[model samples]
Every structure is written in C-alpha cells, then in structure tokens.
Target chain A: MSLSSLPSVSTARSTASLTADAAALPPRAERFGRALLGSLLPLCLLALWALASRQGWIGRDLLPSPGDVLRTTETLVLSGALFHHLAATLARMLAGFLIGAAAASLLGALAGSSVLVHASLDPLIQGLRSVPSIAWVPLFVLWFGIFEASKIALIAVGVFFPIYLNLASALARTDSRWDELAAVCERGRLARFFLIALPASLPAYITGLRSGLGLGWMFVAAAELMGASQGLGFLLTDGEQTGRPETVLTAIVIFALCGRASDRALAALAARLAWR
Target chain B: MAEAVAVRDLVVNFGERAALGPVSFTLAEGSITALVGRSGAGKTTLLRCLAGLLAPSRGEVKMLRGQGRPRIGYVFQDARLLPWLSVAGNVAFGLTHLPRAERREAVAKALAQVGLSGWAHARPGELSGGMAQRVAIARALARAPDLLLLDEPFSALDAFTRRHLQEELRLLLHRVRLTVVFITHDLDEAIALGDRLLVMAGPPGRIVADLPVSDTGGALLKRQVLALLEGSGEEALQSPTLRVLAAHAG
Candidate 1:
C-alpha cells in the first residue's frame, strides 16, 4: 500500500496498550499501603526514641522521656494553656501575614509595571531583604515597644521580602506577546493590568505567599522569644528557665507540627490558585 | 465605500537600527493581503504598527473607517490565550464594552464559527494546540472586527491541523468578508489564501515587491517571490535589471 493509504497502525496500537496498562494497575488500597510503607523509617525512629528513654541511655535531665513529655502535654491540655498559646501565635501570624503580603504584592506589582518605581525602590528593598529577620528584632522592639505591635512588625518584615522579590520578577517576566492582543482588543492600560498581567503572574504570587508564610512562622517565634507573656516561644523559654525538659520538647514538637500543617494548607491554596 | 488602509512612508527603528520601511502601500477593504518574508524581515513590526501596538519611528498609518474608529482584531504566532480563563471567557475578553447578553451572544456565535461550541468551559491548558489556536481565532471573531491582523497564526501547527485550519479560515473569511492582512513564511500558503502578496527582504527590512496573485499564474508568482527573497533580483523581474537595481538604491 502507498504511504497515504497505510492504516494508522501505530496510533491504534498505542491506544490499546495504554488502556491495557491502565487496567493492569493495582487498586487504591494497595497504593495506600505503599505510601504507608514509605513512612516506616520515621516510625522506627520514634520506636527507638521510646526504647532509649525506657532504658535510660540518655540522662532524664537533658532529654526527657517521651512519657514525661506526654504527661506534660496532658497537663497543659487540661489547663487549656496549650490551646491558649497556640491561638495567640496563630492570631499574630495571620495578622502579620495579611499585612505583609498585601503590601508586598502591591509594591511588587508597582515595581514590575513601571521602570521608574523599579529603579527607585528595588535597590533599597534588596538591601533590606539581605538583613536577617532576627537582626531586625532589637530595632523593631525599640520602635514598637515590647507589645503586640513589635511582634507583629517582626513577622510582617519576615514575610515581606520573598513575596516582593518573587512577585516583582514574575510581573516583569510576564510575556510581552499578550500586550499585542490587548492593544488589538482596544483594552486600556488598567484593564490589561487587571485581566492579563495580574492573572498571568498568579503562580509566582502563590509561590511567594507560601515562602512568606513559612518565614512568617519562623519570625513569630523569634519575636515572641525576645518579649511577650504568651505563645509557643515563651513556653520554650519558660521551660528552659524552670528546668522542665518535657515542656521544651513539647513546645518544639508543637512548632514542627504547626509549621508542617500551615505549609500543607498554603500548598493546597497554591494548587487551587494555579489550576490552569 | 472601500475603506482602505493607507501606510505612508513608514519606518520603524530600534535604537540606531532600522527594522522596517521607507516604503508605502494601501490595502483595499474586503481583501486578503498575505505578507511573506524570511525570519527577522519585520513583517511582525509592520503588523504591530498597523495594530497600534508599536509606534513607527517615522510615517503615518491611516485607516479610512466610515464613521467611528474601526474595530481591529489580532491573532499572534502563538495562541497567546489567557491560561486562567475558559475558552468562552477568552473569546468574550474583547467584548467587555458590550452589554452582558450581547457579549454572551457574540461569544457563542464566535465559538460556533470556529467549531468549538462544546469546548466553552475548557481551560486553555486543557485544549490541544490546534484547539487553542481555534480559541484565539474565536476571540478575534467575537469582536466582529472590520480588520483582522494575523501573525503566522497557523505556522506552529502540524501539516494536517494547519490545512484544516486554513480551510476553516477561508470559510470564515468568505462569510465575514472582513479586511485581513496575514503574515506567513510559506509561499503556497500566501498563494492559496492571499489576493495580493507582499514580499519583504533585507537586514533593514522593507517591502521588496507587491504582486497580485492570478488563479492561473500562482506558480510564476511564487517563483518571482522566491527569487526576490533569495536576493536574485535580476532573475526575478523580466524588465531591465539595472533599472530595478537603481530603484532599490534610490
């Protein structure tokens, strides 16, 4: 047969094979089992920790037994202190994150869209970003005092840089080809910004938000450590001063769990925003 | 009224370098003009000038609209659809000035025209390349433009999809009868679709030749266009070669 008249054999074969391969895949339960198996090492580490504690291989003063940590957790939960501290930390994190994210996105967009704004502000912003969040703590404390304002300011500062840099770069890098379409469609400058430029930069903006929130959590701890009556940071410091290793371990665990949970939540949000 | 687009001594320069034009042309309304050129030939520069996306360093482009400003639609080399929007939403983008019902009706009609009526809710990322290009065409159609500018709209597609889309575009033009200026690198495409073909050439690009495509003389015209583009200037023209050289020099 001539080339044009040949049957589309390869196409048909590929489709059939794809269908067969999909059908041959294992069930959902087996996939779940595989995922669970992947976590075996971390579970083993926990088992080892319990074993070491029961045998007293490590001194109780330096490293509290898992049982001791659990008992402390129970006491804290019953007295509602754990929930109180967690709630306070969450509130501070949310407030600072919203403020910082809002400012960064607005400024970043301005810088990205206009050459003048970028030239005027980018150097200073970049310079400030290089300074560690912890280094700003003393200055923030002096400026805002030892109140909630200082803590919030510290968290907000921590959250600002990643979001600003990411969003500004994203906006600047948005495809110029779309501008031609906008012109032909007779869309005005403002309309193009809202409908095209902003939406196009969303994936980058979402990424910046995730990174900012992670840093926001870290800064909140630093802020609370320096001064403040409540929060996880305070609990850690207080545990140290009181010689309660169990309380310190409990606080660290809570911080890790909360950080992971918040990161996961932000990731889900980013996925939803980046549905395209 | 023939509503022609008259370009007068247009020149575009980037920094110290000229990109296109110390040339002039007029495209009569309701006609398709295919602009064929090599890469970096400034066909895109000319199109952008016409679309008012880029300002020419020198010269004026006048579109003789009968009344108000003429509505213009443009399709780029790539689909260039907004990824966040659905097919229908992208089509409806230019129709925001219209009333809601009118916009919806326009979008539906455009989608139907492009054979994408059922894919209205699909995101741009979900569609295949051909489908996305069709959506881009639908977006241009939804505006009901008097003039449509296409910059290599089907050049990225495979042969089968390109031919299919070319046929569909021809049908669309026959029904709409809008003025069109299409850019292409394919000589056959220019011959098949254009009523008039403009060939561009040079490091500092300019339109080298403008010829009408006669039904029986497409092959001869293609040969001439190829010769001109390849810088075989003397061989392309049957008239005196020295005169053509003098004209180019001047």
Candidate 2:
C-alpha cells in the first residue's frame, strides 16, 4: 500500500524494468541515443571546468571559468553584439559555400567527362589543393580588399578542392552498366545526366558538401581573425587586445557551438537530399 | 522456326586487334540457342553483340522481329544487380518509367516468378549467389523482352541451384515463348538448354561445328557426341576439310 501510494513512480519503475535492454532497440534509435550522449559530454566538461575554477584549481585570468564565459556571453547577447558578429560570419560562409559547390560541380563534371579536361587541369588542381586557404588570404585581401569579397573568396577557395575531387571521382566511377543500359534505352546526354549521373553521384556530392561546409567555416574564422569589424573571429581578436579572457572564451564557445550546429544542419540537409 | 536474328560475316575488333570475326549465324524465334566454346573463343563477345551492348566492328547484325526495335534483355555472367537496391528494386530497374502501383505489381509478379516472393525487400548483397542470379533473370523477364541473352548466368551456382535454375529457365521460356541466346563453356549446359548447339573456334573465331541437340536430356546423347568428336579427330588427320576446322579450333 505504501509503494502503491505513488502510482506514477511505480508505473515509471515498471516501464524502466521492461525497457532495460537498450541494445534491443533499432539501429537508428541507438545512433540517436549515442549522439545525445555525445552532446551531453560537452556540458559535463563545462560543469567540471566551472567546478575546478570555483575551487581555485585553475587561474581565472589565463583560462576563464565557465561562469565568467557564460556571464560574458549573456552580456554580449543582451547588448546584441554577439548576434551581429554571428550573422556576418554566417552570411560569409553561406555565400562562399554555394559559389564553391556550384563551381566545383560544373568543373568537376567537365574534367571527369572529357579526357582533355582531365589531362590539362588535374595537375593544376592537385597543386592548388595543397595550398591552404589561409595562404591565399594575403593575395585575396590585396585583390578584393578587407570587405566581404575577400572573406567570401577565401572561404570559397577553401571549400572548392574537396567538392571538386569528390565530384570528379564520382563521375569517373559511375556504373558503366547503368550508362550502357541508358544508351540502349536511347536516352540522350541531358536525360542520362538527370536520370542516372545526378542520382548516382548524389551520395558523393553530399559527402563533399559536408566537408566543404566545415572547411568554409574554418576559412571564415581565419579571414575574420586577419580582418573584420564584426564577427566571432573579430571578437576573439578584440578580447586578446584588451586582455579579457572571459570575452575570448565566450567567442570561442560561440564559434564551437555554431560549427557543431552548422554540421547538424548540413547533415539534416544531406539526409533529406539522399532520402532514397 | 522463322529466323529472328541473322548475323553475316560479323567481325568484332578491340581497336586494331580482332576478338572474333567473319562468323555467320542465324537464330530462329521462340527457341533457345547455345554457344559453346573454350575461354577466349569470343562466346561472350558474340552474346554481347547480339544483346546490342557491343557493336561489331564490321558486319551486319540483322535482328528480324516484325515490330519496331524489339526489347532485348541481357543476363550477365554475374547477377549485376545494383547493390544499393532491394531485390524488387533491381527487378524493377528496367521499369523505371512505370507508375508506382504498376511497378509494385510488376515487381511482385517478377519476384513470384523467380520463387523469391518473400525476399522482395532483401538487398542484392544480402542474397545467396543463386538468389542473385534469379534476381537477374527476373530483371530480364520483367521487361517482357523479345530476345533474352544470357552469358553463363548459372555458371557460378552450386550443382543443385544450377540444375534448379536450369529447370526454372526452361519453364520460364516455355511460359513466355521468348527467343534465347545462351553462351557457356559447359557441354552439359549446352546439351540441356540449347535447341541448336554452336561450337566456336579460337583467336578470330569461326563456327567449327553446329548441331541440333533436339529433345535428348540424358548422358547417352552426350557419350554419342563425345564418340563423334573422337571419331572426327581421326577424320581431321586425313581430311583437309576437317583439318582446317580442327586446326583453327585447337
């Protein structure tokens, strides 16, 4: 009677007992559970950081406590400074990523389809890909100025090579049998591309897109660090100049959060694109 | 037994090098023909040409079916089902333009025909070798093709599965009444499946022997054929006509 007094708690206990074997769940559900656990790990780390700082186990000035970083983040959010910087960085990334992906796809398709294109451009692409996006920042700044163009250009260049390589390889390795079947069906070039080539290369394209997006973000951060009035990267530079560890930590946290969120968004988009 | 396919002086070359050529043949409709030869005897090349997957470098391949271009289907040596697609999807690949409901019905009918009704949703990679080959057959049959070309479709199967598929193929052919052109290295297969048996010679391939196996399925005819081959071997030593054919085939 005493245990039955809390009926809801008793029912919850019974449900928990029934669902004890977590491994019996479907793979998709299991994957989601694992991702949720991974998400919680960062929060746990933050809590631990806050605890250690509170106990004076770590210095607050050199490495700001989680509380201090949170306070700075909250102040920046209230004043609307963080939002402006976040928006700038995001806009640059978006513009650059789209341009890069489109260009890569077109050029890669050409290179993959024609022997002459491959013979002429493959070496050049390989050489250029070895050079980091940051290395181009100086020349980009000189040519395009400190405005949005330089930043976007730098990000686009950063994203281009991976997408190009993936697309080219995808085209090269297309199922010859499918192509032959299409030929037998009397499908022309355009029809073949839409019906077969595009769908066949979609998985590779999405994979490249994911990598490109990540690279775009990295390049944006570097571009912002070099020069930019309003961006998370600028925030880091400002914090360094003023010797404010809390502000620096806040900017870093925001950058990391945005990067992880963008990855999830891209992953969601990719999953939708490749639903088949 | 009207001629459905007629090939005259068919020459296939890979760039400058000839694979097989100057071989003339005719195939009758609603009957199965088997091309039996050693490896590199252009059996596959000939089948591929008949399937329209490969164009002969020189020669006329006149396929005579009364209608517009007849739908020709090919079953490769391997099943060649798309790994990403389910067994049903693989069968329905040629039916891509069909409406969803029609495709579903077609897929169900094909899977049922192949005795794989319950395994519709299974991926090609998940299936056994024999099951995959059945899926390939289903893929071809689903198209309702006028001519079906099979290149060693059951060569890799275990003895039981091979025999089972052979019987299934025979039944399917009877039900559909479609023309078949099969290529194989096995005499037993040629004896079992073929209406007309064509034996090919090496290098620039030519037809050395052509025989009608007729309705004989047992080994008696096989032994008789072997005896004839041995008897012919001695005849080749003396007769110039047999000598050239033997030399080229050897």
Candidate 3:
C-alpha cells in the first residue's frame, strides 16, 4: 500500500522514494490470507449453486446437482476419457495459438512499421477481424473436411485477429524518440525494430496473446462441435444427445478450470517479462 | 584542435516554414561547444540535424569519418534509457558491433566513468532522475564516439542534481578526448560547460552571436549572452575575426 510497493516508473515519485525507506511488504501469512480473500465470492457462488441443486430450485433435467456432476467427472476420469478429451483440446489450442500468433506478428509488424503497408493491408485485416470467427468454421470444415487441420485452422483464424490488432496498435504507439536514438546511433532498420520497437510493444503483444488464447478456447469448442469424436466439445454434444445433464455440467466445469489456469499462467509470465 | 564536425549553411523546413537554418558552425575536435538560445530558438532542431535525426533542407552537416570511427552519441533532455534494459545493457545498446568481451569491458568502463559501476544490473525504473541521467551519460560514453551531442541533458534534474551533474560531466569530458555539441538555454550552464558559445534566435532559427568563455570574465560573458538572446548587445557576431577566434581553446 506504500509508494515503495508501487512500481518505480513515474520519475517524480520514483526519485522521491529513492531516499525514502522502503516499506516492508506484508508477511507471507498475511499475503496468503489476502489471496484467499480474493476467492471468497467464487466460493460463495459455488455454495449457492450446490444449495440450489440440492433443493431442486432448478429441475434436475435443467441443472444437475453438484454431487452428480462431480460423480460424472470422477467416472470420466477413472475411465481415462476426460484425460483423452482434454489432451486433444489442449493440443489443438496450442497448435492454433502458435500458428496464429506467428502469422499475426509478421503481418502486424508490416502494418505498424510502414504507413504504406498499413494503408495497403489494414483495411483487409480489419474487415476480416470484423467477421465472427465461428462463421469460418463451416468453410474450414468444407475445405479441410472435419479433420484436425480444419479445427486448427478455425482456431487460428480466431486467434489471429486479436493478436494482430494488439501488436499493430502497440507497435504504432511505440515511442518515436527511440527511433531518433537509433538513427543517431546509425542502426539499420532491422536493428531499430528489434532493439526499440520489439521490446516497447512486448507488454501489449502479451495481452493480445492472452486474449487470442481465450478466443482460441472458444473456437476449440466450436471446432470440436464440427464432428469431433474425442474432445470436451464432443462430450458436450454427447451429453446433450444422451440427455445426461451431469456430463454436460462436468465438461463446462473443466472448460472453466482450464481457461482460468491458462490465463493465470500467461499473467504470471507477463509479470516477469512486461517491464523488467 | 582539428575540425571534427562542420555545418555549412544548414537549413531544416517543417512544411513550408523554415524551422532552422542557414545555420553554420564548426566543432573543434575535443572541444565542448554550448549552443544557447531562448526556448523557441531551434537549438534542438540544429542539434537534431547534427545528430542525423533530422535532414537539412539546404546545405549539409559533414563530420570527420573514416575507418574505425563510430557514429555520434546523443543524450536527450531526459534520461531516455530503455526501461527494460539493465544499466549495463542500456550502456551496451549501441555497442553491438564490438566483440562480446570488448563490449562488456566498454560497458564496465562507461558505467565506472559515471560512477555507477555498482548499479550495472539495476533497472532504469529503479533509479532516481540523477542516477538515470548518469546512466544515460554512460550509454553515450560506451560507444566511445568522437563526437557527442547533448540536448539539455541535465535540464530535467533538480537544481542541486543539475549543478552536481554539470560539475561531474565537466570532469568526465575533460578525461576523454571527445568533441561535444551541447544545446541549452541557460547561459550559466552553457558557460560552465562550454569552451565556445553560439547564441541562436527566431522561428527560422539562426545563430546570431558567437563568443568564447573567458575564464577571467564569466559574469561579463553571461551578460553578453543574455543580451544577444534579448536581441541587444555586443558586435562579436559581426566580425569574422571574433568568430574564428571563438573556436580556439577556452
């Protein structure tokens, strides 16, 4: 809560705080207590959910009891079905993210660095970004034929737009004074991009990547729904077709957990890499 | 002293209007030339031109260049160190051409020169304004440039920090065989740091006066520079004899 605890970025406060005794951070136990406090609302919501299911406030067909969903999850795990489905979806998400991020970064750099490139390419990119990613699913299935490639291609399309948007804007917003420094130092174009533009845009690029990953998760469900046999999306469809609400609830819970976990991982990585 | 950088009737245009120029001057190698002017006088425009960050619309800037010579080292008003880089990495930014060992040595030497050898691994965001400016100086010195260009490098610091840096910078430059083009509006700072003074004036900025800092007559020179900036005073600008003589060692 002290100024010293804040990141020393603003020149005035940072300078003044330079001589001010650094305020000690809270003890480990107190810090841990604060973290636990953050989960209070989610835990309360889960308790409400359990009570509603227990009292049959929602019909069993509409909302399965929490116990039923947990039992279903355990059965799926014991049968190794959950692992197989979850692993398949994670693999697809990773592949889509890697492909999407690479392609977006290349095109984004082009657009951001040159006004000519932005003029020539931004309209098309923006137009494409405006299209709902799910709209591409049918076309991708038709072209790649309901295989892993089609699913990956669809997710990649979803991931591409946000990362591309963030990176282009971030690069555009980079401080021009560094470019002046590069010119004075006689650095080449490539050097300027790598030395100044790249690091300057990294925090935003990571934000874009995190959003792209979430979008990829959304499309992964849609991707698997396009006739996947072994995935969480397939499990959802199977639960619905078989009229088992608990199975569907189990899949939803897993999706929530996985998405939260991935985002948290990325946030931790950003903390390490953002401003050094 | 030898000629290190020459500006010949240089002019820069921001659209149709002239922002600087028909400005001409020569930097004596190993000498510190302080350019003094009012805020709108375009000292920065001229410095940018000399630093090759801006191109002259008319005339040119010719620097002494040859094999093994590095490009110009520039320091802006603020520290401007890349926040992500460590002190050593920031100093080593422009030294990528050197071998790894030589680069390390140069970074160490530069940091040491600024009295920041112990803080080589610290982040710029962690430093005070004075410390950050010292790191900026180290970054410039690491390149071992023959010519260094500074645009009011210490103007953002507190008065005490500013005065302290001026003294430290003067001593540091004295130890190196480097020529400097310093831009500042403060006549006291200019006189304290420079061997020669160039006074600039106007929208289409031009150097209206040139004078040397005489060790015996600091107050007199300060008054003259103030008057020149105020469009009144000494005729040293009118005579070729004074202009040539001002380039000599202080």
True contacts kept of each: 0.40, 0.06, 0.30
lDDT of 1 by residue, B218-242 (tens): 7877776766677633334334542
Each model's DockQ score: 0.30, 0.09, 0.30
lDDT, candidate 1, at A223: 83
Candidate 2 stretches with Cα past 4 Å from truth are A1-59, A120-124, A184-186, B15-18, B83-112, B115-131, B224-250
DockQ of 1: 0.30
The TM-scores of chain A alone, one per candidate, are: 0.86, 0.85, 0.87
Residue-level lDDT of model 3, residues A97-195, one tens digit each, is: 899989999999888888899999999999988887778877887898878999999989999988999999989888988887777667788988887
Query: lDDT tens digits, residues A1-276, model 1?
Result: 211121332243345456545655667898789879988987898888888888999888888888899999999999999999999999999999999999999999999888899999999999998887789888987898888998998899989988999899988887887787787888889988888888888888888998999899888898888977899988999999999989999999999899989989988777667743
Q: What is candidate 3's DockQ?
A: 0.30
Query: What is the CAPRI rating of model 2's predicted complex?
Result: incorrect
- lDDT of candidates 1 onward, in order: 0.83, 0.77, 0.83
Candidate with the larger TM-score of 1 and 2: 1
- The number of the candidate with the highest TM-score is 3
* TM per candidate: 0.88, 0.80, 0.89
Stretches > 4 Å off in candidate 3: A1-30, B64-70, B232-250
Q: Go through the candidates in order and give the clash count of each.
A: 0, 0, 0
Error of 3 at B27 (Å): 2.5
Give the C-alpha miss distance for residue A95 in model 1, angstroms.
Answer: 2.1
